[model samples]
Target: MGETYGLLSLLPIAVVVITAIITKKVIEPLILGTVVGAILLYGFSFFPNWVGDLLATMSDPDVVWTMVIPALFGILIAMFGQSNAGTAFRELAIKYVKNKQNSLLATYIFGIIIFMDEYMNALLIGGTMRNLTDKFKVPREVLAYVTNSTGTPVSVLLPFSSWAVFLMGLYGSSELLDGDGFTTYLSTIPFMVYPMITLIIVLLFIFRKVPMTKYVKEAVARAEKGNLFPEGSGPDTEGFEDELEENSGNTKKPRLINFVLPIIVLVAGTIMFDMDLIIGVILAIVTCFILYRLNGTMTYSELFDTSVKGIQDMVELIVLIIAIFLLVRVNENLGTIEYVITSVEPLITPLLLPGITLLVVAFLGFTTGNYWGTMGIVLPIILPLTQMSDVNTSLVLGAMVSGGVFGSHVCFFGDAVTLTSASTQVSNMSQIRVSFPYALAGLILSFFIFLGLGLIV
Candidate 1:
């Protein structure tokens, strides 16, 4: 910021992007970047400076809100697991799914419907649909594709999701934004081009309107011969199968009410609470407690244990959130965004902002395999730039969202891809190879759409 670094202001970000890509990890790179930025800012005294700044970041109200909300959603999800509601919902839906085509379609639809969280969506859809898809001779790659495609994209696009709440909290908490986060998020919905296009592409592929890649075609052909994967070539389960079995096993048959009622409370309560996601999730948890208790699905001790386990389940996410906040603070000190804007401002017009934002964020998201982390770094930068340039706020925000989802959709090492691969027992690389072309197609279309809209709107 003080011309101490000039172009070197970008060093930390470069370290983060490059390290993340090379190592296929997010937290370590983010931490390393933060350390690098801190050193750049405070020289030999970086340790205390870093700790102070990180503590400040951790204590920020919005950061606390972000941390709390995800844990709450985890609790709600755990409750859903205890109720076997996802299984119930799956059982109910699979009743009508009689073939490969319908099985894929049903997986896609369920992926969208289970929009509360991406992890839940990936695991639920992949785990529940795997046997059915296998029965119908659908390749694991295909199942992985449908599951991964719908995971982050749909979760981010919809308002009721953990992704949405986290994003909205980020937007509203930014001092650059004057509008309410929920309203701003709703405004971005229509312009979120990538997810909509990706969903359409999935639908087209499901209906056989889109041609499969040769690899996918080969996989499909193999599946038709009753081989879901090449012998010994599937991903190492790494205990995922056992984890899934442990989590999903229920002696009692899954009741539809156990699945449907809590979700209804969540959505309806959120709306009733004026879009307060935390309260909404709390209400849903309470509803789950009562419903499960009345139905004897869980005793008080079991319920409490599940609640604690749920919070435990979210520790990794919470740690990532903390690291993201730390990196953001370090970047602020390094003036990373400030340097970027100064260098790019003369070259970038408002008409180019949306498309450029999409491309840049998409590249970052894909390389980092951390969509939320990427957004945490860029949103602070982009929001300020948008205000200065007078670009359409929602348009640019939409592009940002679209780009993040695009990256998550195709990145082989991304959480969604990893989880889906593990859940469906396909190699992570195999799913990415199968899904990349379609994701790329959507990316191209989204970039053009953003460009045109930037010109017109």
Candidate 2:
């Protein structure tokens, strides 16, 4: 259960990736990985006991709270779409964004502006922009890619975001760091090559400078043929479209206020009240309901049903998140992360440490599908290594952040990917397949950037 197992602790992650590639499925691989990790942690005799422990961990108040925030956000998104606020916004956006290029650009801008929380950014922006992107034949996969890439990357880059606050606390508490944690975080910003490069890469895609991948090209081709989704690959929006149609018969017009005001309340509430994302979303949902009802846009019963429908739409994503949480728990109990760090200790040097740490953290984050968890486990270990190895602290810190961002963007089961898929109504695997090449391109670029910085800094 500790670092005593050394390299053997990596078997679970290997199992996950190999199984996933072979099966082309995520849930089974994740479950298999978790079970293997449990067996490794507790042995054959206590394997049943480990399952009980995992369940108990998943039910912890903090864990449940984290899970609920996304579910509530899902409800808010569903309400937006159901109330035709998303449609209204799309119509409004189309006025300024007359073509595919401007539509994608507009989506990216919204992602940057909603940087307070990654989950909110993905759900709100993805939901609002999907119809607009559809109008221009900009493929759901492309929309998913834009929303997914910008979600975590933008949050990590912004100083006022949840990511920054969590990282500040992490760095502040670390004995290895010498200066104020906030200042140290700020210093690492310039060296955060991955997210910065990721944004640039997205911009290139928006401007049509980057070539579309095969999947994206196919998606675009299909859209040109008047197909919104590839054959057999659309979200289960059975009741969603029906509800929107029913609401269309109402006398109230689809004003931009229905879309804009709720988001303002959600963002402002989060910052001003220092509220949890769940609270902010709850307030937004209430505001949307009040506005829609007062304007006679939707009946009270219709609003309640649509909100529930929205929550139902996110059921798959919520389940994926819980499964991932269990996988993370199993990884912790198996000490997989600790093994990776300690195994790399003997090979690290001042010049190579930054690039090496970035790779290792990236591997862990990609495997675990939880970048925040990767950071929590990795920074504590790698920061101490940097203190003793004569490495440039800021560069190493930047590398860690870069790796986390890259992993979040690429991992198929990562929260950002799942949430983006759910919000944009694209399948999770479709989003990953289309976006993998681009993410890899960024990762390769980041590795070289870090390697050069490692030598100079």
Candidate with best lDDT: 1
Instruction: Identify the runs in model 1 with alpha carbons over 4 angstroms from their true place.
Output: 1-5, 234-239
**True-structure lDDT of candidate 2:** 0.74
Q: Which pairs clash in model 2?
A: none
lDDT of 1 at 284: 88
Tens-digit lDDT string for candidate 1 (1-457): 6255778788887888889889989889889989998889999999999899889989988789889988998998888777677777667766788888998988887887789899988887887778778778898988999899877788988898878977887776767777877888999999899999999999999999998889888988998887888544464643477767765566665777876888898889988988888888898899989998998888999899999989998999888988987887777777776777788788768888899989988998887797888888788778868988999889999999999998888787788888888888877888888899999999999999998998888
How far off is residue 408 in model 1, in Å? 0.9
Q: Whole-model Cα lDDT per candidate?
A: 0.84, 0.74
**Candidate 1 colliding pairs:** none
Q: Give stretches of model 2 more than 4 Å off.
A: 1-7, 98-101, 110-152, 155-192, 205-253, 315-318, 325-342, 357-441, 452-457
TM-score of 1: 0.95
Model 1 clash tally, residue pairs: 0
lDDT of 2 at 370: 55
RMSD of 1: 1.8
Looking at model 2, residue 70 earns an lDDT score of: 56
